[model samples]
Target: RRDTGVWDGRLGWGRLTHGRAADVLKNPAYAGAYAFGRAASSRKVRPDGTVVACVNRRPRDQWTVLIPDHHEGYVSWQQYLQIEAKLAANRTSTGARPPREGPPLCQGVIYCGSCGFPMSTGYRRADGTADYVCNRARSDAVTTPGCHSIAAAAVDAQVTRLLLAALTPEQVHLALAAADDLHHRHHRSHRGAELAVERARYEADRAERTFTQVEPENRLVARSLERRWEEKLAALAQAEAALADLAAARPVLPEPDRLHALAQDLPRLWDAPTTGAKDRKRLLRTLIADVTVRHVDHSRAHIGIRWHTGATDEVVCDRRTNRNPTQAVELVRSLLDTRSDAEIAGHLNALGLRTGKCRPFTVASIRHIRQQHAIGSKRNDPTGPGEITVPQAARILGVHEAAIYPWLRNGEMPARQDRHRRWCITWNPQTEDYWHNRVATSSHLKRTNPNYETGQAV
Candidate 1:
């Protein structure tokens, strides 16, 4: 019963609904504190000339009156504060993110060192590896270059090593002490539930005794007393059931010797198949307050670990190899000057070379790599030393580019198509004369003059 001997509009002795339970938890009065003006009411005029009243709950700082230790409480003030903190942390929006299920070790606790904001976890579809990216600029729609991103693997490995190192023998001893405290707390809570059950049983027995003592001839009094006894018996059963559940939910604590052995082999336990990502994250968050990471360069990243003990540690870890290997990029750059995108892709695939994402090279992928690295495509550049386009070949042979295409198609002229399927012919003084003679001797040939360099009009 939540009765306070006041005229509050509550039955104070019924099955509690979820909303009522939440209200009870949020009220500071239950924690031996007096709070006033926790909520504010306002009246607003609608467009239809109707007044609508609204009630908004205020923040703790905005409350009008608050007095600690105002009266006896169901829970201590410290427990109430802890409960509030936990509720705030569980909220996803505008609150600290709780540990979630994912492969990223520092998902919720990671921050961007550059912008000093929480980083978001993202996964690369190509390789399925995770990344921690500082998305402050993007999320806020600011006109600034976005902050850096670091691969999760390197940062996670470094933090894991640090965590294992911090778990020294002395630290294990302290952990055992914490475990002991937790066991005692659980025992005390269970005992409290048992005592409540005993009190409920006594209440039921007293109600039964009163019902038996009522006169059988007094029908009204006898019926009322019997009904009261039934209610008390029901309450006793509910209390006993609750106590049983509490006992069943209690965790079994390990012996000190076993805990020490497990602590010694902590690394193996962490990597065990039974361990899950969520479990690892929870364990990590217990010791680490937060981790800030920034990419120093392509090959290294700086990591800062802030522990729960107010101590901080910094480490530099080598970043994972770039998706596109240095050797692969160099090879692509070298081939871009001479080969078409298709030809380069083919050569790369033939040499057992894959892109940074470990996928076989494709024409589109090659083009993307070229554009990303600012390497010009062969088709975009003018003819190089021994190469000429169809237009150039046609100009030298005194024919239209369309006419040159026929010879190329018929294999009468040696040429190759670039990535876009445009013909490229080898051009030189000798090759030019050779094509001119071939054109002049062909029955399908036409010229402005029989003799070359006559400069005559058509």
Candidate 2:
């Protein structure tokens, strides 16, 4: 619709400007109500002999010809008003407000329970992965923000499933009704355009007559009339061109059977990829007035949907994992020096903390968590990166720490002591290979037994 008839420049009809389109959409007449004296223009004379005019819209109560039920319209007056409010809410300039345009079904609807600010939408690296993030935890002094996010796919799926379950044929029927209205709307538009052309032609003719009838010596009045005539002709040409285009592009009315079939498959059509995000949102707004979401925890969100008819629906959608790594980092860093991996995991579970997959923490999970956050562990030597404690090395080597002590005293073992006097050894591939070779040659075995059994040295 942006470039409706741009096939060839000569015969093409350009689309309306953004401001003009918005004005047309916002007009109350489109909703069937007719009114007069809706706007007033005030002209101010400038110092340089130029006139400045400003138009101000008057309130509906001030209108002289206000009528509630003027004629049949595409939408009811109440619905038209709701659409206007929704449009205002959808504007990004309306900060921390609802009714935004986005793929995240709950983007504008969900407010942070903690700070009462509207959640914002973000996208993951992958396509179709949206995140509804609450950024209220942010502060000027603190570099780390307490903002939280939820995956959009799960939330959207839950909403869609719930919505489809609650919906009846009424929504589909309304859409069908709109389609029927559009077909009839063309007839009304054709008539209006024809009348406009007629009016413009008359004005053009009248101006031309006035210009011709003017005295030849009165050049000022003649020039003014000539300019008015030119303007009227231009208006007439525009109206005629629109009328021609409308006549040419008017669609043949679809058969009743096709409409019936389409209505029957309306649900399937709604689920189809052909239905765009904007249309889906519009359809949702028709039934759902507002949806409020509260983040109860990492995995769970309590959602409340308010329907226009004073009814409400509530449900909880839980994710399997927590995506925010900030919480895990802080928790693990505090517990690293005091607890073993298993003990730390137990503590995490006791605190009701879960991983990104929403699973209970395990020893390996704890180790991985510590590794990710650079937390020092018994298995992780603090001297250099990838260093292990003597006990850890002994376990890896399939021997006792006492065996490592003897080697350390004999100057055969390479190790370092930390501030706590705990021996640290680097366990690499070479370490394991050396242990395997020593075991193969029996160099690391205790000397005994053979002489005692044979009663002689062999």
Candidate 3:
């Protein structure tokens, strides 16, 4: 289709149909090749014993007569073969799907580990996520009804991390080198355009001088000289326009420091909004042959990756937990009396825990989880006789209450939260001395009370 002449309404030709398009693509004559025996007719006997004539298309290799470069063609034979290959790959029945424009990274190369069959991709309407599923029973009658279905987010995240790890800084540097080479080539082209402009200017100047020196009395010769001069001036103008266009089209390359930073932070480039799923998939297919996924349990899965270099890798990934798993809810409930919502959220995040929605825990989310489970908030229960609240402790230590919070967080000061989510510290003499010395020696701590003494404030 590349070199084929365009059709116009004036020719009174009908529009191209799908069948006609396929026929043209499959024809070797369009690719400047000649062939014979493209199809063969044969007789087949039906179950009723009646003979039926059938025609079957033959493979290119099976053709009896074939010749390349037979005549001018719309496309080269190599381009035609590539198109055929692309068409073949696009067919789903071929067991090889081409890279699609979807967000699933392993759409074409993911397989079910249990049944060893190609997995199909499905999107969840609720979250718009691509999931890999293998309907083994539907595909094969002999297989069991149960099959594997895993969310693409977890698997794609793992595979993307691995792919980014494989692209070392060395590879990034090589890419930078390629970019520099491309810039050099662009610069050379711009220089060539400038040289062309310069040459044209020189020719025009010479033509103008020749025309000026011609005798006015020789009208015929002068007229010819003037026309030649005008042509040279037009050529000069055209060359100058081309040079201006080239200058405007030139791209601005990144600075060397930015390039170095990009090499160090290649993931930023990979995660850029401009980078699409198809690009990421292509990069993955370059190194990874195929990925086989098997769910081990409700919260875990086993991922097997076969690289193009024949090496293989296996890793276990924990699946996203339910929104309010019993374990997580129980943990939150247990920590409720001793910790506030913010503290609980921080603890969960430190433990690498996520909410049922596969999101990191926040204070609001933790509070929501508590409310959903009917867990009571911290109460204002009375403290023991020897224990005092945070303000009392701060007054005893001769420092602002805000100054004591960091010590409690880092466990530098021994304390506990009351039922009201307020810090309760024991006010013994030894404890007082310890905090007094801590505040005295701590440069980050400020003693705002000018009238209070330092030793226990008693």
Candidate 4:
């Protein structure tokens, strides 16, 4: 009989063998375990070679099992290729272009004629129109007085027109002729001076030689004469060397064609590029003599531009809405004054004047003004005698030394010093009297009552 019913219990299977199971399952662990059997039908024969049939039992059912073990995971070759492609793309993007170089000219070059300030540059309204603005005129803090802000475009246009007018054929010829004439005259005068100096030196050398010959026995006198002659000769050599150097350094006048080309192309060159193109400071110093900006109202200005030709020819342009010639001339005169830096600064400050940037007058600003004016002695120790030592004077004054230092250093204080290291502190006699009285009172208190406090002493 065959057992074909489903089995619910655990079941397992192993290799089956008919002839010697021990020989087929050599391992002891597999031999001891019973091999699960499957249901099957067996055929049996009759008395004369007949087959016999029998039913077999089914194998026992087994529960599903899970094994915990380490295994390697696989990635698609295509995904690896994509990752490499991304890395390469990133590197190519990063290596595209170089950084821009620094600007050729910076804000130090741009100047506002109206306010005498450096103009700042910026882009306008996200469009390509670049603008330069004066912060002083635009700021709320500048309520005292000044011109309104000017558009860079308008200023550039005005500058272009002015340049065109100034560099005209007639103007160019005049400038060239004037420059040539001045150069020649200067050369002649310089040569004459050189000859005079040489003649003077020769006469002095001859005189010294004559003196040495007459006083041959006088060793001291003879040595002095020889030294004088040597000094004179050295001076003459130095003068000649200097003259040679100056001649070598003299600028060769530009040819007519070069001047004409410059005149024609200057406007375009100035306009096409940004304001920071080339050495603008040197350019301005070379070309412009002075720029005078006069305010007609809050928003308008009249500019008078002067060139550096020997002749006094100037171009006047209305940069603002109104035109005022008289005011312009006054402004020009103020711009071209020959005064000490301090004097000029004080005058400007007193008049409530400000620089182009609308900042208060400073010592540096005054210095630049002085340099422009070419005023005062260039020699070291230009100060006259009798100036007081500032800190010492300040100590005596019972004030901060800085306050008095500026006064003394700038020649504001009339006090003088003597060889005894004593300061003859002098000022207006009336002011001196007040100080003297104060000193006297302080001294009296100090002497009579040693412990008395200053200002509290009776």
Candidate 5:
């Protein structure tokens, strides 16, 4: 309770369940700071050839990094601290208690392979990990540790991958169709806003016409109509403002074409930050009813995912306990600085360095490895002294393929169309200099803003 100075120096409230309140405390919106760090840990080695970590609650004073006033807050920082303290004080409430809801992603559906009991979830303070722990030993009042402990992330991620991959082309097409219908539905759903503007305009126009028809000598009627006209003008302005506000607040839904493209891009959707955990879990729960996890040795887990369609998928997860692939990942990253995916794959293949097992190196395989590790492209360096493609130009220009396409589409930038209809861009000093210094500043689309920065056409 005293960890973050939120303790009131008294413990009276019952234990706070891990619910929406807990989720808020973990959120920076509820906290005045827009970041998270509550505790820290240090590792110590024992004399018996073993390593252990000692975790300690870090008072905010010892926190080396902090950013204040980073965002709009739901509450003051002090209030946030007080809430944390009050919640922490509830842990020691002495009594038989009702079971709280578990993590949203794996509640009531996950079972321990050893004891066949549902695993309980907790937030690991040291690493801020949502962990699932089987506490059969503790439940039976034994001194030994629980039978199993695993981070819910690895399991959840694997399940999500399976679900997304299982989307057949027909299903993808259907999803695209639904999204297209939704886009049209939402766009056409702006009738209320348009109606308000129409009504206001009619009233304004009628008021002005009446004012114009009235005689000036009839000051009584004249003044009344004038006042009425002013009121209508104000109302019209308000309605227009409201409409503008609605337009601004409305979400930008993707076009049907973009949605169709996205349906084929499952990995991008799965990896995007905007995809919420609850939504992912919901998708997973729809496809898969339950999952049974069994640990094999230290770094491997046997995963059995049971689908709702009476099918099962088995997977083996190699979760490292110490989990430092820093050196290996760094090697791949360094290679990415100079070598193409194919070149890196060939290089690795020649050196007898395969990923975990003896799998052959391929360009597609290397691409996945790079995406997983967040390695940037080496296309900027002009591989093998040949003419570059649009994708290569994009890498050299530090932009996307979309930005390069418009230039080629229009006659502004020089491009050669090969027999394969592929746009081949030749590397020239003049073109390179122009693109690096360029930023789009003018409208390209008829009714929308430009696609690139500074709004200039390609």
Candidate 6:
């Protein structure tokens, strides 16, 4: 016989029970009783018993049981495994697997060996057989060098084979060992150099501060010293920031187990989802320094892999490669200066440069480039050469053109009375040009030309 009751104890809501000693204390009974107490830790459970009694603590703080034999104990059961399994299942369903180890071998990853720019990836057939191509070949086949397209499937297969070959037991061990050694040496050297540089900068700053503090009270001297100190402080701050960034950027050396896991799972990396592939690419970037691809023919290409772990394990893969349009543009930009928007556009078109969206470069795109470089009318330099149309000014200044009448009435700006009663606003060309020149001048010009001479131009 057993009796059960709800017990509201100091701990929290609980269940109290009393039962026959033999029945309550039996192994099966004990197991069930213990499970009940454990569950009560997170819930409320009441048991009915006599000789042996059980009482679950309140607030689920502990699973306590009181025996008629004058013994009390706590019990718990494993529950986390089920929860973990459910959570893992949920994650998989939500596509939350870990990131891939490498970058996608597409437009952003594949680079031309000759031009050093990303090569575009495209499908040659509907069968999903893709190709890596250079912008020069697709757009300006006549002028661009090595405009040949390579099949993506073929290249991927070749690269996979090469990677497999490199992942041999002996090769992997050597690579892992080399990676460890290199990482250790790199970490030590980098830290030492960084510390030395920081110390030097700190000493220099202290010396400069001391000198400035002891300097005479001349205003000019004081101003110069202040400027020097400010410059020194800025430099010191920048250096320290750079050092911190480098320290943070330095990759941690993977342990043996992690390295072995990566080696074991290298093949699956290629088949991973886009995110997984990206992670694998990042890891590869950490381990391997460079990949150079050269086109041997329309169908065949050679890839050379350079490991950053101080080992020159050059594995060649056969694939097709193309040049990046952006890189080609950069190369052309580097070779010439003062190129007009039209000129640049023409050059790119002739040299086979196209937009990432697969469109030919328009005048707008050329203008965008000039704007980026702060050149010509597209320039944003407050003092740069540009045209300011009245309508544009009206829109920018959030005013009606008619409102400009007030400026003309006050002679704040030049104007002419129209045939009707209205006035037409006009800018003083000389004043405008003078202001432009003043803006373009260096600090020395401000010192030399202190006054604008109201009516006079620069």
Runs with alpha carbons beyond 4 Å of true place in candidate 3: 1-12, 138-146, 171-266, 321-458
Worst 10 residues of 6 by lDDT: 69-78
- 426 Cα displacement, candidate 2 (Å): 12
- Per residue, candidate 5 scores C-alpha lDDT tens digits across 366-389 of 776768767765544333344678
Candidate 3 weakest ten by summed lDDT? 1-10
1-458 per-residue lDDT for model 2 (tens digits): 14355653355356779987787668887788888989988999999999999998888788778786799877788888888887877676856344445666665666655566666788877444677777665543443233466777667777777677655456556655776898799989999999999999999999889999999999999999899999999999999999998997787766666756765676797789888777777677767767666767776877777887788888888743345256766877786676656777788888888886667888778777767666775544456776777766655555555767877667676777654345777667887799757755776554333444344653
**Model 5, which residues run further than 4 Å from truth?**
1-104, 142-146, 168-262, 326-458
Model 6 ranges with Cα > 4 A deviation: 1-106, 111-118, 141-146, 167-172, 175-250, 268-299, 304-458
Better of 1 and 4 by TM-score: 1
Clashing pairs in 3: 322-356, 323-356
After superposing candidate 2 on the true structure, give the runs of residues whose Cα lies further than 4 Å from its correct spot: 1-16, 23-37, 41-55, 64-101, 125-128, 135-147, 168-270, 319-458
- Stronger candidate by lDDT (4 vs 5): 5
| Model 2 alpha-carbon miss at residue 249, Å | 33
Q: Which is better, 3 or 4, measured by TM-score?
A: 3
Q: What value does the lDDT take at residue 252 in candidate 6?
A: 68
Q: Which stretches of candidate 1 lie over 4 Å from their true place?
A: 1-51, 56-86, 125-127, 143-146, 168-255, 318-430, 434-458
CA-RMSD of model 1 = 15.3
Q: Per-model C-alpha lDDT, please? A: 0.82, 0.72, 0.82, 0.52, 0.69, 0.53
Q: Tell me the tens digit of each residue's lDDT in model 1 across 1-458.
A: 43465745565466779888877777888999999998999999999999999999999899999998999999998889888888788879876688787899999889887788888989988778998878898988884343777888878999999998888667889877887898899999999999999999999999999988888899999999889999999999999999988987887777878777877888898999999998889889989999988778777788999999899999998777445766667888888767777888888889898886678989888878878788765557455669888755655677655677777899877777655456777777887888777787888765433333344553
Residue 93 Cα positional deviation in candidate 1, in Å, after optimal superposition: 3.2
Model 4, 107-143: lDDT tens digits are 2334566567655666556434554556665665664
Shift of residue 255 alpha carbon in model 1, Å? 4.4
Q: Between prediction 3 and prediction 6, which has the larger lDDT?
A: 3
Candidate 5 TM-score versus the reference: 0.31
Clashing pairs in 2: 320-357, 320-358, 321-356, 321-357, 321-358, 322-356, 381-387
